[model samples]
Target: MLVAQSSDVSTDLGVYLPLVVMFVVAAAFAVGSALLGPLVGPSRYNRAKLSAYECGIEPSPQPVVGGGRVPVAYYLTAMLFILFDIEMVFLYPFAVSADVLGLFGLVEIFLFIATVGFAYAYVWRRGGLDWN
Candidate 1:
């Protein structure tokens, strides 16, 4: 019994050895890259290099209006994107495994879709999708 347990422990360790090694290598590489970047990279700083870049558009020194406050529309659009993106992320795995999950999964997914659809409808009704 003791020998059997010892062998099983050794077998488990053997199975996990490659995974452990991979994590160690990944950590070492990330640390090495971070430490080497500043030493190897250019030290020179100029106006162009230091200036905030916005897809080739020059950043305004001050807000054109409203004391530099950003529009709520931008945040609303971002939240909507995140909501739908998370919905898709949940959907993909279920779609791939739908056949194995059977009727219960179908019902659950319908419920999930319905919930998201209600949110979408609410947003549409409130003119969240309107550009202006």
Candidate 2:
């Protein structure tokens, strides 16, 4: 009937028409703001402001050969820190799901801890942990 056809058209338009309108409005606003900013902003360029700033340390003169080489141990320590940090992050989700996962979760977490511990011990034995 006419009523049924009218209801169907209204239902479809109600869902999709608002979404289309919102998308168009948001896109227009974003583009308008971006384009308007440069026009209204001040245009002043100076040497001090233009120079690369590094937290008020004053940019150091770069050596021709990338300055002196850094120690490998510093990099190794950073890598180890990142690895353990990631492991800790993964543990949180496992801990939250522990109840649902039951003893399997416990076994898996314990195995993970043991593996990480073994790696740490090996590194310690190899003097990777030593600062000197």
Candidate 3:
């Protein structure tokens, strides 16, 4: 009985292998640079270096919790902006694949838009969008 040699052995480096090797090399370089940096760089440490500097000005003393009371409207506006921004991010992928998704995708997106629009309307009615 003769043994047959495997013919499926790959002679070429796979597409993924190059990516793996690239990542490995990048990691090695990063680690090596980080290790070498402290050894070769200056070892200066002083009181001035330890102090916190704020935009070419001295740091001001303030309460640990916060400096006086601030308006809640500012935070509400920022939160609403972030909420809509994240909704946009979710919709982008669906928009890009609209052609492949066909009518079903259209229905899904319409439902999503309606839900988000209702939320927006509710916020508007509750005065969450108001600046003052």
Candidate 4:
């Protein structure tokens, strides 16, 4: 019987030096921009600029009875936008690799599109797309 001895292996910390440096640089740049923005940016402040922006609507000086509640339409529209946006995000990868993915991928993508289409139809029926 022959006994084999394994040599001690040391982990190299230098491999991660670039990553650490990059993170530090990014953090420094963000902090520097935030700190410099207030100083370098324009300080011209008027009533309009100081007022709370509600889309393009003019802000009332007096507060509303219920703390000025925003309309549900704003939120619904935002959610619908996100839903479709995520669908597009999923679609890009599938489109890029469609040939490699073959029939199974094609079927899966169609199912996904169908599901999204159903949701779109439901929203349309519910008047979610209506501006007013």
Q: List the pairs of residues colliding in candidate 2.
A: none
Q: What are the C-alpha RMSDs, in order, of all predicted structures? A: 4.0, 7.5, 6.1, 4.7
For model 4, what is the alpha-carbon lDDT of residue 131? 95
- Global fold similarity of model 1 (TM-score): 0.69
lDDT of 1 by residue, 79-106 (tens): 9999999999999999999999999999
Q: Predict model 3's lDDT versus the native.
A: 0.86
Give a tens-digit lDDT track for model 4, residues 74-132.
89999999999999999999999999999999999999999999999999999999997
Q: What is the per-residue lDDT of model 2 for residues 16-66, given as tens digits with 9 covering 90 to 100?
A: 987899999999999999999999888898988888876566676774377
Span of ten consecutive residues with least summed lDDT in model 2: 60-69
Order the candidates by lDDT, highest first — what do you get? 1, 4, 2, 3
User: Against the unseen true structure, what C-alpha lDDT does each candidate score?
Assistant: 0.92, 0.87, 0.86, 0.91
Q: Give all TM-scores, in the order shown.
A: 0.69, 0.54, 0.55, 0.69
Candidate 2: how many backbone clashes? 0
Model 4 quality (TM-score): 0.69
- Model 1 misplacement above 4 A: 1-4, 39-44, 52-67
Q: RMSD, model 2, all Cα superposed?
A: 7.5
Q: By lDDT, who's the top model here?
A: 1
